[model samples]
Target chain A: MSMHIMSAYDEELKYLTRRISEMGGLAEQMVAESVRALVNSDLALAQKVISDDTVLDDAERQIGEKAIVTIAKRQPVAADLREIMGSIRIASDLERVGDLGKNTAKRVIAVAGSGIPRKLARGLEHLAELALVQLKEVLDVYASRSPEKANSIRERDEEIDAIYTSLFRELLTYMMEDPRNITPCTHLLFCAKNIERIGDHATNIAETIYYMATGAQPEGERPKDDNTSTLGSVND
Target chain B: MNIMSEAAVEKALDQKMNTVPYKMIGKDVSVYYGEKRALFDVNLNIRENTVTALIGPSGCGKSTFLRTLNRMNDTIENCRVTGKITLDTDDIYDPTIDVVELRARVGMVFQKPNPFPKSIYDNVSYGPRIHGLARTKADFDEIVETSLQKAGLWNEVKDRLQEPGTGLSGGQQQRLCIARAVAVSPEVILMDEPCSALDPIATAKVEELIHELRTNFTIVIVTHSMQQAARVSQRTAMFHLGNLVEENDTDKMFTNPDDQRTQDYIMGRFG
Candidate 1:
């Protein structure tokens, strides 16, 4: 790409970062209210979060269009070119994250009358908070170009993993203790897993931001032989 | 060649130039062969920054139209023009316009490499020195280097800037011509069938240079090769019988043109 075009791509990257930050704020709110709706059985707030998904979808569409126009007009190349393009990929992930939050909120409405047991509800709330914190941290790293912040998010993702493992074992133990608890316990386990997946997606966004700022794919141990390795694992 | 034909040519010579975007504009633009109308009534405005390729069968005024931008036609005998062809927003055809000054602001790389009988450094520096565009010798050196860099010729000639430009291969020589053109910082650069005399490799080199230069200078190229015109020019203006039949974006004009005549010409159904 020409120098003029690369600078234009930089402008597009800044615009995309702003849009993502706005979407991040919305996603954070959705997660908070979604857990609250679960704890308090507030079907209205849960429904509102589900219905507001169209806002995130609209933001995704706008960011996608901006990236497409940047590609068409500026013809970015190398790493500078990749940043504008990476926004589209990251925006798609953010949109999916929104969908996942909406799905969790919809689950709240599913069990509106009979919410999950209080103990399982606490685990879900804890998982949601851990995921939200990691997501917020990853976003901060992305916006500030801080590798230290990104590394901290990567470490904090392990906290979500620990919560997921505890929630999984707790649900399994509950099912083993009383077969009557199987249905709700399984639903709660899936909800916690959903939150865990949100943390994973946040990590993916962090890695992408690292690539955008530093032009290096996040350094880690090379994975074992997998023919599709270059394609990267989805939502990670 | 007869009286009726002479009067028709005279009438064509009388029409005023229309300077409009997407059209090559020339005013009272005239060319002569001891009193003959190569182009008449040639008032035209070639649209801004488009690759307006001049294509027609030989001696059909396409090449003459391309040359008039740099006043390359001025070298010919009895070639008299009484109007203007402004590029972007500047009137280039005014009589008071210095041909040297005009040539600097509107550069030309000819059908052949035609590098001056000098080193590659001299070949590029010739324009800057003649125009006095550089303030110091270092400034002149930087211009030569940057121009060559922009032309994609720097790497090949960097080790041998002092070597005669004529010693380079055909493609290198043409790139040197391009470098020479860029050194003067022209807003528009005219190419007159630049690849005609080069081998396929050299032709490709010139075409690549044209693509690269498009970002900087509005290029108007004359090409006998129809495919070359289709490949290089964003907008193609096909001239026939001393008239611009169609001027459209390259893809559209090649695939589907407004005039049946242009469609025929592009498809090789007619010239």
Candidate 2:
């Protein structure tokens, strides 16, 4: 926890931490704004979310490049090496989270002018809220360097999965009840799936934080509850 | 702070069953130069057929520990050592043990290429000649050729076997020293910064040779370069201020060493 003798190395590591935080914050905002764009059918906000994803991609690329240069220059070992590698992995996951948010924003465009049912939007809003909380908490866990908080974050991913599975069922039932609902319902379904995947990316970040902080992967299976796979087809 | 689990997982996944056998064991090993203690109550083990790297900042007793393996410290006046260092079942420092024969079993290569001012062939055959391992001229020729081949220097030096070893390039001289050490067929080879005096290309060749040599001889290397330790050794031990801070698989030592001192030292955050 002391500064590196070559203070420049300490600065590079600090720069990595700061970049990851900035990237995490941007991803979180994109996911949240996309959900808000979906619920209110706000076209401009949805466009802004789509445009903002490129920034996350750029941040990821810059962080990855900087990490490689630092490795070449410092030949860092021990925790410094772990921190660099973790930043690369975490940046990758955050980039995917940004992409998922952009995917959700595209759905907002598909459902923008259409009259989406209030109940359907409500389910998606709840899913997005839960996923955002998970994303926010994992980023905070990474910043705090507390492996203990990472454990609870991973265990709670099952809760997000449970919600997503129920929402999947709900969306299917809505489609079946009215054939006219199929067109708009499919977009909402994709949006819900994207939000669910954002939750999964949050879990991935949590595991990475655990490894980065403690240098050991979290033990045991990661208690996944995404049972949508096991359910019989929509006919069932 | 255990970081071996990931490396262990990879090994388990690969289904590798490399049961490590200890080639040498040091227990309560302490070294003193008259009144100053250089090492304090160290307990460490060297794995058979593996490269064990000893690393620390200067004056941290890494070299002192390396010397204790073959009793190189005994040559220093008033230097006393009290502890058991066993090479197999024999205490290397015991009164009845022959230091000369022990050194042949545990040969060394120094930081600088210190080949004797003799023909390259004699420089390598010198150890075998002294030990009388070769009975005939043909036997000496075979031992010299094989030692050079094993040291990865034969291809460059085969045509000029009688030339003075000092005439070759720095890297070639270092490889010649390695060939000389290999000539004795030592069970354990001790290297004191074996690449410190060579260029990067030469250092790389020596590193590659060290990897190949692990099949035949257990090696203990004392080095100041953390990158070299990370690259060449299977197991790594960190010494700081006369104490062993952490020892672990090289994979873990470079990425996630246990003690704070080990991490700080490796990361150039030494206090």
Candidate 3:
């Protein structure tokens, strides 16, 4: 039947999209500032990032409720339904990423006064920066539906792996020189790797967005530089 | 390949298994019976090997959408449908399309127990005979047996193939109609409230029949019962006031919907 096609329904869909975008924005900011806190060694900023996570978590719950309502009410199909399912999955990944950022911030609090070498700290900061760039860029790709940007994000993940390798090696050097540095350097290593994993999670979100928009999984693996050896344990 | 590569290949295969055939595709479809519009710009792909349930309140277009699948609405004068509806990838409404051939590929069982006024075997074989779907008497007998078996009626009706179809109870009659629809060897079957006329026991039988039919034919069913929709369909499409309110995997749509309207309807706040 040719009904009037109510504006109320249109407004509701727009509201759902807006709410999800709002949640996504909050999650992105949490990851960025959490990394910034690590780099600047600002204990207060790290604490603030941890405290603000409940807001993002709560946003996930809100968006989840809205998504359920949309599915019940709209009966969307094809591209529309794809986008909604993608958004639900993305919300889940975003929430998990939020928790990971909180964990990183808590690690910052733990390793605050360990007097780690300046060079090791620099390596950690570099890793954080690479991952943060990947997160922001992948999210931008999702918002714009730019498969080119998504492809680039997939490509950019290699830089994060490189930074993690560099961080791993530097931390190993610290442990080799001073047996006392083992505990703190190990914690720092995990912190850097956690940030790298967050980048990977963001890449997963990018892949879903690409699928939702284009109806295909992105092609090809990102180039991995073979020259880089594994960061070997000194025992080996 | 290494175990990791083998695992990835297996994962891809598992994904491929998740995709079944698409039985029906409606593109920009709008249906109107004279001045009354029953559906508006409805676009959907009914998946194969799955039961798809259309649910809505009275006058909400669920039945209209279901009838459109088999072009059952074509019988009503002044009923115009704009846009394409394809069954098994062939546009069913194309001018060159033979209505009989189309009906043979896509058969429908109406809301009530509408068994033909003929012997059980005759009712089941009517379509196949008219369409010449069977090549011989033995072929017709085999078709009837398979259809009756598929409809879960062979055990009761096999000895009474000569008995009149209308002599059966309402539930048995509905199953007979289902058997008749299946007799033509259709690629897809459309059911309009196939259980509406039956008792609870009969409804359960027909529902079980629908579940079994999914293995061979894509089935689209319309029901007023939300619980039935949830029970039967892999995917559920809900309609409200001639618009597709929401469609999704049945579980997700019922437990979690992306629209408030869908939520309200499923929760029984309003249609």
Candidate 4:
């Protein structure tokens, strides 16, 4: 974050980074709160998570507009250009993270008061814990401008996806075991998917941070372990 | 400090092998003014019908390297340029070469819109008339029309061709200067921040003109604006502290320059 000879330009860029960091903070909070609500069946807290998403949405819009203005005014090039572009991209990903958290919260209301299986709830909580960790670490990478940390965060996504695949299989087994468990297990399955998607959005942020730090897109293919979509029927 | 062999550095820079014939070539070029060296061993190739941009911080020798192309530096007392500069295989600095003919073949536009005090028509016609490029009145008229049209200022000043060239707005005057340079049918055009004195809209128009003019003539532009270099040039050469730091494709140079000094300068971290 070297200052431009024009201090005003430096201030504008700093403001842009600050707005993105604020959005990241809010997205991470929503993800954590939504999962807490789901695990505890706190319907009011879930509703709170849903309503708080607008803050992230507003932050994203502001960042986008600010980035556009900064570009128009400063006409940044090279690393400065990358920094502004990275802010816009990271803001969008954080907004998606907020949406995913909101969707998870909505599912909490859908399955409220149903005597959920303790094991299924715990499985979802485990997935949320991992996703929340990824989200937090990726945010740290961006804040610190640490490409190495971003790379590690990107690599850890596969572990989250693997856990999600296992969760998907366990939920499918529960649904097949008892006809009564079908409704709750299906909702829990979606919750697990939402958490998995949160992991993905975190990985997207990691990739963006890497680009911002190095001025080049991360080389090679991203490690992917999400196999839930490819799973066939449990009868097989 | 990281040390690399010259060949290794050159390979890492990924200099593209130019296939087209060069309009101008400078080999082992150096410049000095009374013991103060301004450039050192700079080698560059100006491709035919392509826009090559020279960019660097102030006093980084970009303009000096540009002046060497057409030997503009020869005008300054004790400003000595040592090296070989060839235009279509003819030595530009040869003692026998006529500097006037060399300048007619290689025209230049400066930072400010310096139109002669004469009428617009006279400004565009001056070069052809002096160079004996037009034999008839019809030829003079035709050259004026075509140069103005190619400079994208034909319609704006056609009715006002009788008006003084300095009477036009800043942008129009700049365009008029460009038309004047084009009037002689120069093989190459050297623009040194031709749009610096213009407004944004005017700058855009001149930039568009530069893009169009490249089809008929080779162009070498020196600009302080990096975005302009990116937008207008196919090849970019970065100069730093009297050294040719890197020369490569414009996209590569801007996005991921191989030289750390180039990266630092583009990133605004260099002093």
Listed in order, each prediction's TM-score against the native is 0.48, 0.95, 0.58, 0.91
Off by over 4 Å in 1: A1-236, B1-24, B27-30, B88-90
- lDDT of model 2, residue A143: 86
Largest TM-score belongs to which candidate?
2
Q: A1-236, model 1: which lDDT tens digit per residue?
A: 12232354456667877998898888778877877887788989989889888999999999999888876765444343556766887787778888888877877755666557788788888888878887887777767877656655655566677667767777878888988777666666667767877888888887777666554566673222212223223642
lDDT (10s digit) by residue, model 4, range A209-229: 899888777766789998877
Q: Write the per-residue lDDT of candidate 2 for residues B1-271, one digit (tens) a residue.
A: 8567766788874343246888999998999999999999889999899999999899999999999999899899999998899999999988999999999999999999999999999999999999999989999999999999999999999999999999999999999999999999999999999999999999999999999999999999999999999999989998988888888888878888878888888889856
Interface RMSD of each: 17.5, 1.0, 9.3, 2.2
Q: 1 or 2: which has the higher lDDT?
A: 2
The lowest-lDDT stretch of 10 consecutive residues in candidate 1 chain B is B14-23
Ordered by DockQ, highest first, the candidates read 2, 4, 3, 1
TM-scores for chain B, listed for all candidates? 0.85, 0.95, 0.91, 0.93
Clashing pairs in 4: none
Deviation (Å) of B212 in candidate 1: 1.4
The TM-score measured for candidate 3 stands at 0.58
lDDT for each residue of candidate 1 in B39-70, tens digit (9 for 90 to 100): 76565556556566888777778888878777
**Deviation (Å) of A32 in candidate 1:** 68
